[model samples]
Target chain A: MPLLEIRNVTRRFGDFVAVDNISLSIESGEFFTLLGPSGCGKTTILRMIAGFDLPDAGQILLDGQDLAGTPPEKRPVRTVFQSYALFPHMTVAQNVAFPLKMARCSADETRQRLGEALEQVHLTDKAPAYPHELSGGQKQRVALARGLVNRPSILLLDEPLGALDAKLREEMQIELINLQRDVGVTFIFVTHAQVEALALSHRIAVMREGRVEQVDEPARLYAFPKSRFVADFIGHINLLDAQVLEATHGHLRLTIAGLGEMIAPPLAGAAPGGKGTFAIRPEQVRIGIHGEVTELKNHFPGEVTHFLYRGDVTVYKVRLANGMMIEALLPNSAPGGAELFKVGDPVRVGWRHDAGVFLHE
Target chain B: MSDEHANLSPAARLTKWLVSGPPFVFLLLFFVAPSIIMVVASFRYPGEFGGLAPVAAADPATLQGLTLETYRFFFSDFIYTEIFIKSFFVALATTVICLVMAYPLALLIARSPKKSRDLMVLLVILPFASNFLIRVYAWMILLGPQAALSQLVNGVLGAVGAGPVHLLFSPFAVLIAMVYVHLPFMVLPLYTNLEKHDPSLLDAAQDLGANAWRRFWHVTFPLSLPGIFSGSTLVFIPVLGMFAIPDILGGTGDMLIGNLIKEQFLGTRDWPFGSTLSIMLTLAVLLCVWLAARVGSTRGRYA
Candidate 1:
């Protein structure tokens, strides 16, 4: 059994549904992420799991026990807020020791736990300083230490690193993963940044419009999204509107408007002669000079409409004969590698079988 | 025109002063002139009949006529000292009571929805629409021995074999009127400060395992200290020098420093002694404000 199970929970505020019927199971010690844009109910779900909010319908179970009416303080879950919510009046040590103090732990035990928690976040030396004296990164670490000091069964983080700069955020992400691994506690994280979700989560549940669009491991979700919204949301993907020409046992042949016909791997629930969308990641497509793509399964002659040089990689927007625009990304292996393709240069773009996914939406 | 005023030349400075001259001259004429007169009068001897003796123009001996006798009389008299102490105690009591009553009401208004919060603040200020003296007199009727409130209390006491209690003409009546009159001063500052506080801080405290009481003790109360300090100072300073409340509600034996000053100035016609008392009251108020500011700063450093 999973460590936490949310069974068809729904929460409504007046006429608006903030969290629709959402069900999820989180395994022990798993790094789970709720990824969505703002107002997509990701934070609401995290709050509900932390017992700060109660669902209007259905139940939340922790260790097979129903948590229907447990208050946040009584629940065995701690949350790291987005603002880092350090008590401005308390010292770092005092903030971290708060939960233990509330539980009426022995003084020695509280001190020992606070020390260890601060050490885990590498902020032990700054224990006597107040929250106002710390930088944004240090404040975030203090908040993390405070949340972890309680040794809760599950930790809920609502965009805790959203306040940090890009470099500091990347550094903290690695530290967070290591800390979670050492503690071996289930972490339910929430974030709007897909890159952060992809880098840190063991499993991600992508949400939209008060509903979970898809839940899968990062790689599988990025490679084989089940819906057009999920495929577009997870990463950069070029979607082409197409019609299914043939659907036999485990294969599909699709004809995209202005682009040539292509065969897709088997996709469940797709009918013959039905409208669908063909999705492919930019990195999956290869760009070559004209007449140099013979080995690939699908090839099309195209002209480079625009190219962007992005230091480590370059992206090229290619237009085929039928006016369908496709994107291809190539690694900048050598200096000025993107100079190989100028605007209006004739090129052939190709992809192997299984590189693209077919979605009916 | 604004650009011209921003320059630091003498012409600009003169122009700036000229533009703002009326209010400054008015302050000097009304406030500074009277304070200077009071300071001069506090050092002079009282005339044989009343008030201060007029100093002769261009008479060098007039400077030597000033003496410290009024200040000496103020310190040497036990009645004056007792009145000062009693006034301080009454002001302190009024401040504490107002704080206790205003805090919860301010928190309620601060946490209320936007439209209701506006209405609550309006209600808090609505009592000021009436005259201050009239409001105190209204309390007089309510706390009188034959009033409904006093009769009800007397009924309760009579059930336990006690006689009718004297409710008015006592310190209790004075305290009730003082608290009622000064309560809005305490609540407004508190509400303003608490309204600006972030609600997420409470949620954060709760998320960290703090219950309602702990959340308030650990988060809300400490954060609202500025409000408390301001509210206390606002209530304490005005109530300290308030003469009307005690005069209307208090008995003959319950005279505060304000009434003593009034007696010296108007009843006894001792202008020098009255000026000395006024200066002492002003200094005391300044000292209290300074002390409150020092304490507020020390606590504010952490937040």
Candidate 2:
């Protein structure tokens, strides 16, 4: 059984529904992330699981027990706030020891666990320092130690690294993953940055407009998005309007507007003559000339309209013969990779038969 | 004009100093000159009739009058010492009462929605619109024996065979007036501090298994110490030397240090003794401020 289950939870603030009928089941020891833009209710759902917010319509079950009216202090879950809200008047040791003290642990055990928790975050030297005396990264580590001091069954992180610089944020992300693994606790991390969510989470739940758009592993959620929203939100994906012209046993033909007809692998629930969106990542589209190779099944002759050098990859904007513009990311591995594509150059962009997926509108 | 200030020549800096010279001269003329006169008068002898003795540096007999006799008189007198001690207790009581009443009120205003918080803060300051003496007179009427509040209290006490209560000419009346007049001083600082607090700290405390009471004790109260220090100092210093509240509501025996100073200055017409008492009171206020700063800094070192 899953350790935490949210069953159709809906929370509304007056007329605005923040979390609209959201349901999730997080297994034990899973690093699950709720990824969305601001005001998308991902934080609201996490608050409901933490018992800071009570769901208006549904039940939240922790360890198979209903947590409908349980207060946050009584619940077996803890949260590391985005602000890293360390008690400013308390030293780092006292801040980390607060939860254990609240739990009525013995003095010896409290001290021992506090020392261990600080050591886990590598903040033993900072135990004597106050929260104001520490840096942003050190404050976050202290918050993490405080959150984990009680050995909660689940730890909820609400954009805990949002306040740090890019380099420190990346370092803390890896440190958080390692800490989560060492503690062996279930983590429900929330973030709006898709890169951080994809890098840290075992499974990512893409949220949009107070609803879960998709929940899958990082690789699959990026490779095969089920909707245009998820495809556009998770990463850079070109969503082309297409209609299924023919569906056979193993191949499905699509007629993309402004682009020629193409045959690809069959998609479930896709019927002939039905309109949908064809989603393909920029890196998946291989750019070449027409005479270079002819074995590919889905190839389009286009003109390179623009090119951007991104250090590791050069992205080229290719406009097809039918006037459909698509982005193609070519790795700058070879010496001539970046120079190969220039503005107004004729280029042929092709992809494998199974590179793109059919997405519902 | 902008190009003129952009140059950093010595003449421009002199112009800047000339532009800012009037306020310093004004302070020296009005404030510093009077304080120097008061300090000099406190060391001189009282005149035959009243006021300070004339300065006489030529004759040794008249120069012998520049003595510490007024300070000696103050220390040797028991009545003045008792009044000083009594005034300290009254100020302490008033400060405690004001803080107890203001903290929850300030917290409520800080936690309220923005629109209602503005309304509440306006209500806190609205009492200042009226004349302070008139407000104290209003309290005097409410606490009088024949007033409705006292009559009601008497009615409750009369059931138990007790006589009608007298509240107007008592320390309780003075305390009530002091607290009512000074409550805003306590609330405004506390409200500023509490409103500026990051509310997520409470949520983080609650998330860390702290219940409501623990959250307040560990997170809310300690974070508000600066406001507490400021509010206490604001209430304590002024309340210590306040003369009007005691004069209006207090009985004949309830003279505070302000009343004593007033008696020395106006009643006896002894400006030097009055200046000495005023200097002592100023020193006491400065001592309170110094103690408060010491305590505040020590507490804030960890915070």
lDDT string for model 2 (B1-303, tens) is: 888777779997887789889988999999999988988899888887888777775866666467788899999988888888899999999999999999999999999999899999999999999999899999989998889999998899999999877889889899999999999999999999999889999998888888999989988898899999999999998999999999999998889999988988889989889999889998988988999899899889864
**Candidate 2 structure quality by residue, lDDT tens digits, A219-245:** 989987888998999889887899998
Indicate the residue-level lDDT of B169 in model 2: 88
The Cα error of candidate 2 at residue B128, in Å, is 1.7
The parts of candidate 2 lying over 4 Å away from their true place are: A290-292, B1-23, B57-64, B163-165
lDDT of 1 by residue, B1-303 (tens): 888566679987987799899999999999999999999999998876898876653776653477899999999988888888899999999999999999999999999999899889999999999999999999889998879999899999999999987888889999999999999999999999999888888888887788999999888999899999989999998888988888999999889888888988889999999999999999999998999999989888785
Least well predicted 10-residue stretch by lDDT in candidate 1 chain A: A289-298
Least lDDT summed over 10 consecutive residues: which range in candidate 2 chain B?
A: B57-66
Global fold similarity of model 2 (TM-score) = 0.94
Give the poorly placed runs of model 1, Cα more than 4 Å off: A245-252, A268-274, A334-336, B1-33, B55-64
lDDT for predicted candidate 1 compared with the true structure: 0.90
